[model samples]
Target chain A: MAGYSNDHIASLVRPDQVHRDVYEDPDLFDLEMDRIFGRSWVYVGHESQVPEPGDFFCTRVGLQPVVMSRHSDGTVYVVYNRCAHRGVKVVNEECGNVGRFMCMYHGWTYDTNGDLDFVTQSEGYPDLEFDKLEHGMGRVARWESHHGFVFANLSPDGPGLREWLGENSDFLDDVAVSAPDGEVEVTGGVHRYLYHGNWKMQVENLIDMYHPAYSHESSSAKGGQQFSRREGDKGGIQFFEKRGKVKSMDGLGTHALPNGHTWQGGLPPVENMSEDHRAYVALLEEKHGPNRTREILIKKRHNVIFYPNMAMQELNPHIRVIRPLAVDRTEIFIYPVKLKGAPEKMFRDQLINLNRTHSPTSLVQTDDVEAFTRAQEGMMTSGNEWVLLARTGPQESLESGRIRTTGTSEEGMRNHYRAWLEYMCADRPE
Target chain B: MTKNNRSGDNQSAFGELLFVREVEQFLFYEVGLLDDRRFEDWTDLFTEDGYYWAPAEINQPDPASGVSLFFDDVPMMRIRFARLRHPRVHSQIPPSRTSHSISNVTAKRSGTGDRVEVEARFQMLDYRPGHDQRAFGGKYEYVLSRGDGGRFRIASKKAVIINCDDVHLPVAVPF
Candidate 1:
């Protein structure tokens, strides 16, 4: 492999193309963990996951183990999961309420807010100057929350969470307001699946509307018709026209914002035949009134990619977290998002729909994973070194500093590569 | 809960033995349909309201509470099998060949009804042409009802695998 300098890395990504090595090289993958994921505001768990004091959730930011813990003062702290003493991983279980984090190796303990609380045999460390704050599990450089959705940045120097979020914040706002209680929570258990492909493949695929009609033909257009990925939905996305030609998603328009954020225009609506939807609408009307409720029901974005690590869909209301294990392996976790004050049946329907769409055995996502695996295999050919992202359509630059292009265009992905280059070429973060 | 089967004679010892053998045969035949790739016929063994559930959590009470690996009602099964049979199903281009084996079978009447609750352990070894062969094993809990011809029609079938919550690759075929 070539030693990737900033200039060489910049050369690899053109405005419309990228080299295959970025997805296949282990060295570059490690560099990205440090340069891109290491500096970005990677999403941790939601505020609801650690609702009570001492509640904790363990997860990864790039390859580093971190814990999101709720302290007695009602603050969430993102701290390194490693023991301050011997580098042993402090939290072993996925999540639990711990009164205090204690290292099993030598009995060093830290407070729920990650301050050093106790240390066994303090006399042994007399030769060394040990301060409580300096010696406790080091916190991430910065962390912030928007609508109870928490994100932590490993590097302190960067745009604040709100500035980085930009127009994407409105999407979360829409989600929160759609709920009768004006909030959302990550309630349902997670669905984790693995794919033998680069993490970028999954991120790129979510925004690539052009491939759906062809790639998902078997799942949606088997008999030149469509099937909703739910139990009792009245209709579904039609991949084929009545005359048997493929339908076009170009009207759905993809919006590209700053900081690698992109979202496709809402999918064509499928009327829900279930009574839960009616109850949900009624509750929203009770809270926000009829006219506002009508506006709230209109979904503006299909899937919102919070680049580098997470993507979310307002349609089914779920978040997908991308964890890269290697250059060729990635694990994805899908968590169902519950709109607060919605009908009980509505949340149940959400879980049921995720089973068909996001689960490992999902009728929809399995085909996607297949395409990703095949793309990984296909990129190994030595003939072509570049993967194309040249597709474009008539686009409008919005006042909000976003580009709106035909949904089928590759603008969303091209936008992602632009942000990718900026992060990869920046000087190493502290 | 329908009582369409042979009379109270099943209460006798030898008759119970005969009943167990019959259930074992039905299970063997049911899985044989899957091995032969007769999905349409396999689905026929279900009553109109019958469902197949593979929960992601241990002893998951219902599909509504959390995500499930699979929970297919008749309509869902139809769509799933239709996609599986589609000519360009890329995931199944080299179609998986599964050999399912079930043993340690037990069957008994529940709640003063002819409704037989059957339990068994199963291991399905699946192989696709150039991919790694995989084994999936779990305990099966089935609620059976007697339909026409006194044959067992599954009212509900639940398979709780040991690693139901483990991160898995794409699984096209049903377990």
Candidate 2:
């Protein structure tokens, strides 16, 4: 914004096309970190991640380090990871339990709720200069949670997390009710992969059903035959049509919700008769009754992107946090979601499936990473300046302001740019 | 070939050394198949119910307990290798070339059945055109059974990379 005006920023985004600078420019990347990630309800770690008081998990909101800790009063707090003195990062470990976060430099300490507790050599500093309340590890402007998922905002002016989540809230609710205990927990372990591409590439790919048939053909088909992704899967989603042409995934449908949220309709049902599956269904039946159980077992949605930072899939039951390292470097952390009170074997199967689908060596995702890295390098071409997103179909508008389109439609990516322009061009107090 | 002769003798010690050397040669050949990109042939070295596991977590109790980089059973291995052969496999366009090195080899005969438990340290240098070269090092644990004609087949091969928990780029090849 220093050299470019608001009009220049608006010029970068079109209704169906966006300038490659959105993915490649360092200047625009900085603006995104400030306007989009800085103001939005960026996802912090889940509540279940720090179940005990004083437990903390260090993560990043954009490029700045932040900590999410549970206080003794049972409240979860998101605060800057910087120390009150000298700006040193206070927490070095990924996640751990500590009574107080003591800065290694000069030994300043802070409470679990990020309140500055102790500072050594107090006599050397003027009491008037160092106010305790003003010097603690800085908390984010606002923090909130829905069903144990925590999101923190660096700005206080944006809509509340619920209002921002919009219709995606129903996606979360569907996930919760599908579980036996009517809850879900982020646990077991995380599977992570890094790609030499922009962070938004992963988010947009989540709802883009068109690419899978081409990008993931290796994993889904071989020697003119389609293979099941899971060992016991009856048949995976058909990538090739009966006439040897690539099948369009439009039938599954795609939804472009407000504020950049997007989701794809449920994947075709695959075969699984494992005891764990039966037992999980039985548990849901006992709670919701036989008729309601049938509805619960049917997946309501597949991949749901929560825009800018996070995405989750009900199919494999995991959340992928897209942490942008730089304009061109991004790290994606995938945490397997466990349905509370379901058979442990079901969770085990989920982990196994994710290993094959989401891990760095994942058969399915490796090709996706390949596409992303190539796109990052190819976008440097001055040959064609604009990256296209112009695919369309019969659009249906929902009462909640969400637009539904064909699964292969590029509406999802267009929706993201719509929100992107809104954020990048919005007036901010200097 | 009797248990009576396999106890506390110089001959038994010599026999154990010979067996370990034989297992090392077998391990070398198995890795060679991968290096040569004879992936389908690599599956032949596995037993009927054999598996290749690369645990994602350190000291992972079992494949079921935690996620793994790979947990391919024999059937999965066939499917994986078949995919690798697909010409349109974008991840394998330039095709990852790997040089595998095995060291610190140790082996012990199991008390029951004609099985040997082998552990070896391994490092693999993998490279694809226009991509950063990566080195993957790990400890390989194998439960190998001696089959007909005294052939050794892998019942299970677990490659526990030292940096298993670290974030990694797409690894198209097994370590």
Candidate 3:
């Protein structure tokens, strides 16, 4: 963090390439933890995670552990997990219902909404001006929820969450309306693991459709075939055989939205409607009518990367969150989502697909982890100074003020670096 | 060799000493098959409708409703075996070598049928080429039922890993 000046930081990212040092430098990683993750809107969790009052879920914004909680008045709060008194982590478990977080150290309490409640031996400090109101559990600077997915900004300055999200926010809407009641819930527990690689590798892999044919050849052949047979569609084999043929531009495409957000729109392998899927479609048809339902369900989207941390696969109904523990280590948390009013069978099937693709023993994801770690290892070999991001392909200026590129193009990566540079060079919050 | 009159009795019928030794030998044999990478022979130890489940959480029930670390019915297990044998699986290219140590085995009648539920603790050391060695320990619950010729076949095998929730290393092979 000490040696990285603005010019040095700016030199790492070019129009078509990035320096390998960005992925390896501890100081630069620390700088990103401060300048990028510290200022941007970091996704915390779904509102449904803490639906009732007094519920809290522990998460992280950058390297800082924070808790999202629901108060009695139906308000959600994103507070740093550290206690105001002794700086101890107030909530220990991953998630639970707590009336108030009482720090085990000295019995300092904070309400579910992150307001300071009581302190032990308060009267002893007579001359000390300890205002309890100012000493509550430290809350994130700015927080908001879009369609139940909550995000918090560590720095007070920046655009609102809606403006930051812009058109990319529709991805969440699509997921919500796909549910019968136009709502979704976070259920089925969490599957988390650590990869021995940089966080950006996983972030990039989220939208990179180029790897499946080669990296996941066996799984796509074996598991995909079984999955396709079950769906009674030409999904498994056709996906691998014709995957490369379907360029990022032609059949499906990518949209480089503002604020480093990117969306990959294409039919996923598991999009085929089974009986349960049909039932959910019927419910959607009744609720939103046929035309809107078709619009919602037909325009299939594989996943949406909200930059830095979250990637949501709407069709599969799960979110992959990346947390950078260190320059060489990253942790991932996958949460499967359930539509509120959808049939149990639909949610059940979604969980099955989620586990089959992304779990620890997943047929598809294990290879991706291998590639990421290998890439990390290769970068350290002193062979290449510049990593290429110049996948030339068809790109268009969209009417919606977004850029459309081939689904496999490195345009999304370039866009991400552009945003990263912008955030890094921006004026620091006072 | 014909039907015996001890069928309806308790420990007196199965004879606790013989039952314990038999189950221990069966588990040891199964371990050898897995360690030797004889996947097909290992798979044959299961009944036709058998399940191999490793829950994400320690006490997670019904993988259909929740996520699981590994849940394979008979056909799904076949697909896994086929995938493991494939030459191009990048994760398993050099393949994983495993050595297992199973102990603390105990068996009890399931109380509903002719099945005995066996419980044991297992520690497996997995070494994959070009990767660090991974050590995994867990409790194994196996329900065994007598099949044709009075041979025991696994109705279900559930592995509850102690560190399932911890940040896991790559799991290319079943624990």
Candidate 4:
């Protein structure tokens, strides 16, 4: 058995260095489920998804299957989606409006709040001493919302949602509150995708602006028609082909704010876009007015990988949920949000854009999927013992609970590795 | 005998005019266009304002408020077709080949003109280089309109996938 001492694991994580086994280890994955995912605030689903009283949506928090339901009193509840009797999953469907959830196996019924309401054979269990109050569905330790997005933390003693979010809350507010009505609703339905890579790889890829110009070259080259001429004419291919050549792909650099928040700015500048994009901008201004609309639209961001599992992109209006199934398999759920009060045509336009570009059927997304899958397969080989995070080294700056590096630096990856090491090495709290 | 003959003749004539066989053939041709990657030709078949929609849920409309898997208009469709055929688009190096089949054509007359509504069941086998072929089966709802020169423009094309909500890999090509 490969046993790791606490000191040994902690010593492996330096500000700029980390062990490769952290990404490949099975024990570390389980430990993470307990330490990081088990304690941190994980996003569930948006409240608008379960607007109605009896509406419910099933999701996974770490490895635990959870159900977020709206009670008759209008309060939302997050409970384990398992039947107390035999641990059978109570809700199997993605979403539905059920007055009460009844276990099909044993006929045990629970109300929308996960309160046990009825049992099939009450008299048969005379001496079982099953208290409905005690046996109510196991609720998450903490459930809260920030701008209509619901999140739950598995640890009851951990930080509050706002405290946990810290400075990053501002970015969340910017995304949610900058809308015209100062509110945004989930317009497009959720789109889920799977990836055959380590969950961390997906998270790291989100802020790693370096890969898009290369990984998404095919997508940008074809889909980015207006920019094609500029990229082609911009001297040698090396200038345009570098990983972070495009301004939009600059997240790979070490530019980030306090509270572990970081983002790449601006879109790939394409010809004729200065005018054509203005039309889209005018539409946004019409909806959100010039000021707030400018705040939401003008800020260019490709992806914001919230530590642990959520990857959000304002440009795409989609939030992706990362669920690590195994060391090699990760499930990604993509939920597309529509700005409330926006024109129907605008939504249609976004849908078409995403479907043509991001959908599994899209040319851009497939290349990314293939690359990640291949990377996972390759890591299984014995040739490479460790993955490298030693990109910028001594140049990285650590300050105010955030790690920063050059705009083209790999400091974000180093930060994540540091956090991962902490989670893996920390002793289990008694 | 003359009156009875006239009634039977009218019934047969109207049935022939419905042209269910011709409608079926039209549907098959439409599927063939997509399967063969005749995207530009497919674009030619749509009216200027024609749309393609796939609901995220079973019966949710109003794509603005409710989520939709796809809701594309003419310009959007054109852009998609362009991307699919782009040379540098890496995902299409070993382009996806799809085989689709359509069945069950039903036509009825609406208020102004004849409206044809048909249900098409399709099983698409998508193959790419180094990746195992994936199979997806779904039902499609097409609303066709009679355009100029006896051509047909699709008013609406909705595909209801069986696994709409499942975590899927990036879908690069059009389904």
Candidate 5:
């Protein structure tokens, strides 16, 4: 809105790199909230979050405050949080079951599917141009779910969630089908952090496997010591650290997909995975054949970026959502994913791993936070105008409708910016 | 008969007072060790099978199912301490400077004479080189037990942080 022309914006992004202003200029940031996030399919809460009728979870699509609610008829709705009367947010709380979202300002109530259920003084006001049916809660343009993960798009005319997801849908299927019953529930409260960096920094770091080796050296070293002991030697000392450690290019590769979704695969199996896999395979053998079960069990990938704002880690068992507060400040919400029909100990182990690796007090996240903060600081420098995305690789390879690169190549980041540039270059209203 | 009874009661009362004093001194010494960054000495204050926990949510009773800010037994604690001291732990590259102030201390005997339940409110000011100084206030719930040489050692320490459910800053060190 602050007067950056489309031609100038298009010039900022090249095939292999992006200009620094993409992360800095407040004008571009505001425009992005309108163009890219305003049109793209952004991840809403999971279906399991609002399992029962009338349950709701408050979240955001771009900078707009929205709520994902479940109706009595088993349908999910993503509605603008604003009340029809005074434009105030209808739901004040984070998440709970509510019969109706009654605006505190004037007591106007809207139903779970975001329909105006009641009015404070219906009889007092004459129905002129405004009708009760017309004044129902404002809804998002489109809402859809893939493998129980709901996504909302703010713009009315665009690709459906499936078309946009494209090849990335398989990665999501891998996560959901890994559950013995082909379902996952969002259990345990979300771990939220206010990061002092850009939202893209977090998204970029999702598949950036190169940084962990340097950033998390201390944690990996200590983990090695703890996991070096024999299994069952000490209670609660699983080879978690060893499983989480980054091995040197052990069958590692990155896959780039349409819509900027990229996945990093080939992580070494976590210790004791075979035992869990055997159990899962046995349970799923009746419904799914041994081959399918093997595929589900052996699908150990670190992370897959859903672009725009969300990333899901299959092995670590968590989904991370980024809410961009400002050009500089962002809030990261991490939710633990519980694979249904798996061993209860599996859920407990995943929770423990989250506590160890992702929590604010954890050694790994602390290092990441520090590095991101430093990156934010460095971006403000006048010395450099561009941030390099061209990592050393022998030209990206296109195989079977997917781009493949070395384990540590920056091709994934380049894929992200390409989609970003496309979205930002779209026609704007003003 | 009357004189012996009175004398015996007085000795028992004196012994209870001495136990409380020892518990207070032990807690204070532990705080000093943490402030001094003497992690090795700090960990030594715990009993062999003791626990160090900081519940992720308020009043989280157990760490088995729910996530925790910290839920470390001995080995995990060792890893945490070693990571803090490791050179490549970039988060602690400059290392955090902290001063812990604990007050409102209260100690009482639990089920048996060997165990004591101590509660204290604490405020810690932590500063890293570039980051702004942060004040973390919490309540410490400690279950202490008498170990060898009649010295009090922590059996469990649970740090309950106030107004920090959705933590924004890095809790790099123990609260």
Candidate 6:
């Protein structure tokens, strides 16, 4: 076995290069689950997912399967999915409205708030010191919300939600408050897909703007075929122009912001803007006035990685939560948000765009997944010892310990690596 | 369900029209164009402002607020077809082979001359290299318009998949 130290690992991460083992090592994956996932504020489910009393959605927080539920009084709660008696999962279904969760093995029931309501055969445990309050379902260390997006932390000692969010909080505010009523509801159900790559690979690709012009060239070309023909030009410009119209589809690459927040700029080309989108923007301006509507419309971002696991993309009204299942496999749960008061035509337009561009069967996204999966498979080989992150524009301004890079920079990936190292190397407080 | 009589009558008439063999023939022809990968011809079946929508939720009426699996207009649909048939498009290198079966045709007049709602159950088999053939079964809602030439043009094609919201492999083809 090769003896590795923090210093040795740190050497692999220069301003430009990273060790290949970071992507391939099983030991490193475990360290990530404990250090990164164990402490970061991981996104759970939106409040709308559990709107009704007793409505719950079961998902993962790190390696733990936790259920997010709404209580009788409308407060949302997150609890361990496992039962206390025999360790069986309390809820087997993905989502449902249930007054209480009963363990199948022993029939112990817990209320929506995760409080133990009753035990099977109460008379048999008369002399036992079983306390219903003490034996309730296990709750997460911390749970909070920014807008309606819910998140939880497994470690109790991490920073508060506001502090962790830092500059990204402003972006979150824009996402939430941009709506006409300043309230957003998850209108559509979630879209789930599996990536045969490391969870980090997906996160890295979220801000990697360079890949689309090449990897998604086919889809972009496909999109371009609808427009009038322009001679002597490969479809790259056409794809970029088309994608650049929507703020969400902006092909501007990565704009690294402070606090590990980054934005992809350049609206999809105006030429490709749908008639409905143009009309909707006009109507939004008419209703909310031009300035406010422009602020919402122009903040084009493909995906905003809120550090670690939560990624929000307003373009598709999509939010993806990454849960690492193994060293190589990652499960991404995608939630597509619906603008509550928007016109049916507008909503339909957005959905079609999302399915065609971002869905599992999307031409662009499938190629991306295939590339990442191949990367995961390739990293397993002993051929290369390090991965190169040394792309253009690594050094940029740092605000409050966060880094920012220009539009065509790889700083987002470096920022992610920096955070990864910080979490992985830091000694846990006992 | 609370029955609205006028709308119900319109719906029944529309359903009766859809059950006719001619309507089924029209649907079969449309599916054939798609299955044959004749994208340009497939797109000609839509009106200028027609929409193709596959919702992420079951029985979801509005598309504006919710994220849809797909909501494409004529231009977008044209682009999709172009890419699916593009040679440089690596994902389409082997190309996706699909077979669609449309059955259980039912139609209803939706209280408007411009609108006729036709419902059908469809099963699609899609195959590509290195992946198993994926089979999708769903109910289709086609809102059709009567063109000047007495042919039907799609106003809206809405597919409500049985596993609509589940995480799936990339959906490349129009369902």
Write out the backbone clash pairs for model 2: none
lDDT of 5 by residue, B54-106 (tens): 88777676887577887877777777888787777788879999999888888
Task: Point out where model 5 deviates above 4 Å.
Answer: A127-133, A221-251, A271-278, A395-400, B1-18
Docking class of 2: medium
- Clash count (model 6, backbone only): 36
Model 3: runs farther than 4 Å from truth? Answer: A221-226, A229-250, A268-272, B1-14, B111-113
If the candidates were sorted by their TM-score against the true structure, best first, what order would they fall in?
2, 1, 3, 5, 4, 6
Taken over the whole model, the C-alpha lDDT of each candidate is: 0.87, 0.88, 0.83, 0.69, 0.80, 0.74
lDDT (Cα, tens digit) per residue for candidate 3, span A42-112: 99999999989998899999999999999888899999998888789889998889888899999989889
Candidate 6: tens digits of C-alpha lDDT, residues A1-430: 3445777667767777788878787777887788788888888888988889999999987788999999999999988888877789999998999988998988999999888888888788778776655688888888999887888998899689888887677777777655655667765555567776788898888888666666766655434333322111223334454445422232355666533556665444334555666665666787778888877777655458887887887665667788798878788776667666555565555555565556666646778887886788788778787788767654445555645445546778887887777777677778
Candidate 6 per-residue C-alpha lDDT over B61-123 given as tens digits, one digit per residue, 9 for 90 to 100 = 766655667777888787777777666666566677899999999766566665668899999
lDDT of 2 by residue, B1-175 (tens): 6676655576878888888899999999999999999888899999999999998888788888777888988887887787788878898899999999999999988878588999999999999989889999989999999887999999999999999988899988788
Q: Can you give the TM-score per candidate against the true fold?
A: 0.95, 0.96, 0.94, 0.83, 0.92, 0.80
Q: Is candidate 1 or candidate 3 better by lDDT?
A: 1
Evaluation by TM-score, superior candidate among 1 and 4: 1
Regions of candidate 6 where Cα sits further than 4 Å from its true position: A1-15, A25-27, A219-261, A264-303, A314-317, A337-349, A377-382, B1-28, B46-51, B62-65, B102-120, B141-157
Worst 10 residues of 3 chain B by lDDT: B1-10
Off by over 4 Å in 1: A1-3, A222-225, A230-232, A269-273, B1-11
| Cα deviation of A155, candidate 1, in Å | 0.4
lDDT of 4: 0.69
Candidate 1 colliding pairs: none
List, residue by residue over A311-410, the lDDT tens digit for candidate 4.
Answer: 6776657777888897777887777776665545555555645564455555456667777787777766777556666565335455656555555566
Q: All models, DockQ values?
A: 0.62, 0.63, 0.60, 0.37, 0.58, 0.38
- lDDT digits (tens) for residues A256-370 of candidate 1: 9999999987844545546777787888899888999888888878689998789999777899999999999999999899999988887887887888888988877888998
Measured over the true interface residues after superposition, the C-alpha RMSD of each candidate is 1.3, 1.6, 1.8, 3.3, 2.0, 2.8
lDDT of 4 at B92: 69
- For the candidates in turn, chain A alone yields TM-scores of 0.97, 0.97, 0.94, 0.85, 0.91, 0.88
Model 1 root-mean-square deviation: 3.7
Give each candidate's fraction of reference contacts reproduced. 0.73, 0.70, 0.67, 0.56, 0.67, 0.68
Clash pairs detected, candidate 5: none
**Model 2 CA deviation exceeding 4 Å by range:** A128-130, A222-225, A230-232, A269-272, B1-9
